[model samples]
Target: MRLQMHAVKFTADQSLLDFIQAKLDKLDTFHDRIISGEVFLRLEGADSNKVKEKIVEVRLMLPGKELFVKEHDKSFESATDRVMDVLKDKLVRFKQKRNDISSPAIAEAKTRVDEEDEVYEADEL
Candidate 1:
């Protein structure tokens, strides 16, 4: 998956970026059709009680739908891990639904429709 990363208020180092990339790359095993994704790493404003709380937002582009997850923690790694867990469950469910739609019954129904269309075209000719 192609991923674009954005750092909101601070610069992210190479090791941190590498960590995130490794985590996201593992997601390919769950769903190979993932087209691309975006990750936003932000430090929450100082106005809040917690100083510089880490926030991670991820958006994944799939075949026909998009998955997004936002998480906050004291560290970027933990937040990213939480986001990955959520995305994994969602991808599994999506794959199951896609499989269900392509079952033999649906395929047979689609075949019938195609045959009817052919017959109608012949009559018109």
Candidate 2:
């Protein structure tokens, strides 16, 4: 899986970049076919609260669909963690739905083949 991270406005330091990369690398374990992803980190001004908050947006590309999750918090790490958690849930659902959609067709095909085999054997007997 390939990850491309963009920090808006300010340049991100090495440690922050490394941390983000490490966090993103683990996403592949959830779904290995993830083609690529984009992470957007934006610094937001304090609203009502005195502390500045960070906004992180994660977009992942799957085989047939795209999954997106965004989070807002005081720390980038926390925001990223939240976003990844949401994305993981979505990914799991996607996988299950995909399997569910294809499994019935597979079972139907197998039944048809078995029926054909039974008919052939009966005719031979």
Candidate 3:
């Protein structure tokens, strides 16, 4: 999947970029269908504050839907981690719903198999 990183208002170092890239890459294991993603890193709150909160925003593009997550923490890494956790849950649920087989479909398949088995047994006897 293609990932675009945007460092809003500040320049991000190579290590931070690599770290976020690695984390986003792992998401493909959960949902390989992910087409692309965008990550926005920004510092929130006023500069007067001794410590500013790091905000991480992620948008994942799928086949027909888009998933977004935002998290803030004292560190960018932690915020990114939290965002990934939320995205993971969403991806898992999305996969589950997509792969779910309806009851009627299951029942129809079972009936066909049962009929075939019965016919085979009768022919044997």
Q: Tell how far residue 102 is off in model 1, in angstroms.
A: 8.2
lDDT, candidate 1, at 59: 96
Which lDDT values do the candidates have, in the order given? 0.91, 0.85, 0.91
| Models sorted by TM-score, best on top | 1, 3, 2
Model 3, residue 61: displacement in angstroms? 0.2
lDDT of 1 by residue, 15-115 (tens): 99999999999999999999999999988874565666899999999989999999999999999999999999999998998888678988999999998
Q: Write the per-residue lDDT of candidate 2 for residues 7-73, one digit (tens) a residue.
A: 8877888798788889888887878789999989888874444548999998999998999889999
Candidate 2 clash pair list: none
Q: Identify the runs in model 2 with alpha carbons over 4 angstroms from their true place.
A: 46-51, 101-125
What's model 2's TM-score? 0.78
The CA-based lDDT of model 1 is what?
0.91
- Candidate 1 vs 2: which has more lDDT: 1
Q: Give the TM-score of candidate 3.
A: 0.79
RMSD of each: 4.5, 3.5, 4.6
